[model samples]
Target chain A: MNKLPDALPVEKAAISDLARQTLHGTVDEATNARGRERMISAARAGASKSNGTQRRRRITRASVLLFAAAALAVSLVIWWPRAPLTFVTTGGEVTSTHDGGVRVATRDAESVTRFSDGSVVTFGVQSAGRLEGVRTNGARVVLTSGELHLDITHRKDTAWSIEAGPYVVRVTGTAFDVAWSPSEGAFVVAMRQGSVVVEGPLTPAGVSLRAGQHLVVARDGVMRMGEGTPPTLAELAVASSDAVALVSSAAPVVVSRAPSAPAEAPPSSSVPAIATSVAPSDRPASFAKLVAEGRYAQVVTAARGRGLEWVAESASLEELVALADAARYEKDGTLARAALEAERKRFATTQAGRNATFLLGRLAEDSDGNTARAIVLYDEYLQTGGPFSAEALGRKMLAVRKTRGDAGAEPIARAYLEKYPKGVYAAAARSIVGTP
Target chain B: MPLTVAARKVVPVVRWQTPAELVQALLAAEPEAHGVLWDRYSTSLRAVLRRSLGPDTEVEDALQEVFIRFFRALPTLREPAALGSFLFGIAVHVARGLLRKRRIRRWFRLTDDGEIPEPPDDVDPVSEQAQAAVRRLYVILDDLDDESRLVFVLRHIEGLEITELAACLKMSPATVKRRLARVTPLVFARARNDADLASFMAAPDQGERS
Candidate 1:
């Protein structure tokens, strides 16, 4: 092979010598040592692999034996019988039964039972309940009358149940209020936080309830599930407290009333200030108040209670933006996008409308992973010179880099650096341009 | 030919004067032969890798791969004296594979289209300007197909003759000359158009050492 000497062709010499000079780096002694060590390690690995067949066979046999031993040990630990959890009651009288059960009866005051697993069950005044059985994992309680508030600590092995008349509420880890009237045959469950599954005679398959939900079953098999925060107890006591109803006061769909059982009805007057349903005349202030209070989940639920898409379309501009912000905080990307699009449509050429375009771009890029659409929307918003111009420009440059590579994004990056030299994306822009 | 060495570490102070001697020692599994082999050819191999895969790319990994392939294919080598050529062929093959993978990765925007490394603090200002021009030249080369890019790199940056490129690339001499002829003007045109490289292109002597 001929070594092309200095008599090389002019075209070859132009870039050739320049590239050679630029890449003229030498491997130092430390680098050579590292390379030698890597090769030696690789050589040792290859040599060991020559006898890998027998070694692998031995490993396989040992692994099987070890796995079998481990499985047996795990089985022994799992199937072993454990002692049941015990508890003591306070502020009430408990009558112990022969079958390791206790009956909690409160005459003039409430009763609070503390369990070993960090669970608390508060029985209301004049209430009667029974702990039928207690086990290592959980216990079963039957509320004969009045109300009971439960705050069950979350554990992986938890299993608790509360039976109110024919309805059985199963709980793993949650807090809720349950009331039952034997004579009235009415049951009500209002979830404060977490979730529970209720199985009943009306519908045997059971209905699941999440936080911020109220369920009531009348004697005539009429079921009503409403969207509102349940009534809060001032002291978890029946004395000095009014009847707190769980039904929504705004649009309470009362199909049938079972003879006005005051003890079983969660009063509307005691509803927490945040969960209070404002009258229809006060809804505009209610929307703003709900957003200011950071009740995003309640806002989403209330918006959906009314036709959400309709509210997005015909609601006032402020209401629409509030709904969009609420849905975004709630992580309901679809609803957030809908409200943003509606804001842009109804209030086009306004500052909020232009700002909606930038938010929609964020949703498109982050939530929907549509880089091309995000770039288009960002470009539209950038053309408007809106409040989010800097942020939108930075996002657009990154989105372009994601889809079109550094070469495609360099012009935008350069523009961004020129305008905002000390901006947030300055470091990233310098990286793309290979500048300091 | 069942060649086997006894299970013992052989760390001999053997100086391999020729490729034939190194290959013989390596085949015999002399542990010291690997280091000696690396000492003899590592510098040129590094240069070749740096030039072919750009300076910012993983040249160390490619260099290790070249030696590993050489070790793996040593048994099949028919002529011991042609070790250098055999290794060069393997380096070209590895470089071609990386170039193809790099193209696919670039299409997916998975990798940056390589940047010019920072010049040393002691580098002259003129050399720094040339480095920027080199960066632009690499960006243009990134647009070429893998085979064409390899042909250009081997012929020009590596200073290989047409016949040597043909041998290294497993192409005919006419094909090498044809690719070189086709790629030269295209590269020069791109360099002339590039603002950073125009100065280097206008005076070509601007890149020369004093």
Candidate 2:
């Protein structure tokens, strides 16, 4: 068997996603109407071509045609069994238990498993999972405990699922990591690339984890998709064997660095994003330093291993902002959003929280592409009237234009220009308002 | 912009909620289905055009051609769920045809605008260098026979699986590979010499033969 080599430029590996954005921006109203017109003409031409055949078969019964179509469908389904996903390889201390579970334990070293579907799953030290069924459209595997990483090749329609106790992380094609421990009693999933839909018996509802997001769920039924990082091994194991006891009332604390460089911010301290759940004495500073150094992937991995349950309690709001900035540079929206959410929730009355709210509103509009949600968040954040007021107004108007009809959007466009005469979005506002 | 206030306030019109339902509507020759199709998949379909055809290729004309063909071929589509993939299949041929025509036009000394693009003022050296490398890559692609170049583009740029490529080109996977191999070295060896693109040849994928 032969395979094609990696022929694309490294940067162009994600060209398809970028191309989609390009198309969205480039396909104007004229192009859309033109394409639609062309399609209508082609369909009309097709119908005309088939008209003579229908006229010639005027005696044919509609009932006979319907019967033939149904019969063909039935025959095809009965004869064909969709191709099954088969295993390619596995590793770690594997044992087939009496309960019909293949227990895989990585005592010290990591174990790598590959599938014929071109998907790879790696288990970190002390981790374990059980082998499960691999069906045609997807596969089911149970993570008994500990950490595991997955790299899945993009598949059309088919989904691969990994079950960890009460939660299931389902993915079509993506790269991500998961950590679950019975003692810790939390199911954590981190997305590196692509997206996954996570739902479980204990979860309130299915929460989607886009690339750069993390989901944390405690055994006590407390779950949040964007509030904190993962818990550490020390928190899960050392302090107690009972995972439920480890559940902290306050969300996980994180100190994030701001953009433009952590050094620019005075005193170089990270802000307290979350309420101190685990209270790691020194980790927050080091974490902030990592973020400042633009080592976002490292920070995420560290949080997963140590359990994001801990952060320096003394971290300042400025430092938290920096940490979030670094996370954004790494394209980790979930982590960034989590930090911002914590800041908004914990320090609501402060200027820091106000800024966080504005940033969150922007993220909701730009990254999430939720125009309706953005409008609400922006409207609320604007009440704070902080440094980002001008920027926020421009973005809010853009969101408004998306939601409002062209005639209705005119007012918002006019309002935006009047507020900021030479604003960032002046040109855009002009186009929307049709101002000379 | 979203639907106007009046339209939203009006009795909520029943609409096709799923791809299957939309396909059914199109099959029935409902005119609204055309708008639905364009709104839903045009962005991705346009991307297919850019990847199959070059980025600079004037896709407005090609895009119109694709939509026309798409409507003509809708009745022949066996799987409604795979509408996106079906569009991709159509795009491969349309782009190939366009590429061939462009090559012929080039050969016949079609009037050239001679419009040269000026470099941006605030250029990132790394990005500029990469763009140049891509330009060189495509220039090499233009020199290859149409069949070989098409295979290379489909395999590399479009990221089509071998089986998918076979179905679209109406050729066996072996033949696709043979045609691809005819010009693979031209790109690989050239990239090997370019500092900016040399790493692409660092190590071939597992099962890939030189």
Each prediction's TM-score versus the true structure? 0.37, 0.32
In the range A1-436, model 2's lDDT, one tens digit per residue, is 2475434444333222322223221455676667657655656676775565566566365667878988989989876787776654456788774644356788888877777778887888899886566677666666768888899888776678787754677789999888887655657787789988775422212446787666665544344444334455445443321342334333433222223122232222353333334356655666655553445555554444443333233335544555455555555677667767766777778766776777777678767887888778777878776445666787888887777755766777788787555555778889888876
Residue A216 C-alpha lDDT in model 1: 70
For candidate 1, lDDT tens digit of each residue in A188-268?
Answer: 788898999876533222457888776776544345555575433222223121232333432323222221221222232
Instruction: Say which docking band candidate 2 falls in.
Output: incorrect
Lowest summed lDDT over 10 consecutive residues: which window, candidate 2 chain B? Answer: B1-10
**What local lDDT does model 2 show for residue B22?**
77
- What tens-digit string does per-residue lDDT give for candidate 1 at B24-45? 8888888677776666666667
Choose the strongest candidate by lDDT: 1
TM-score of 1: 0.37
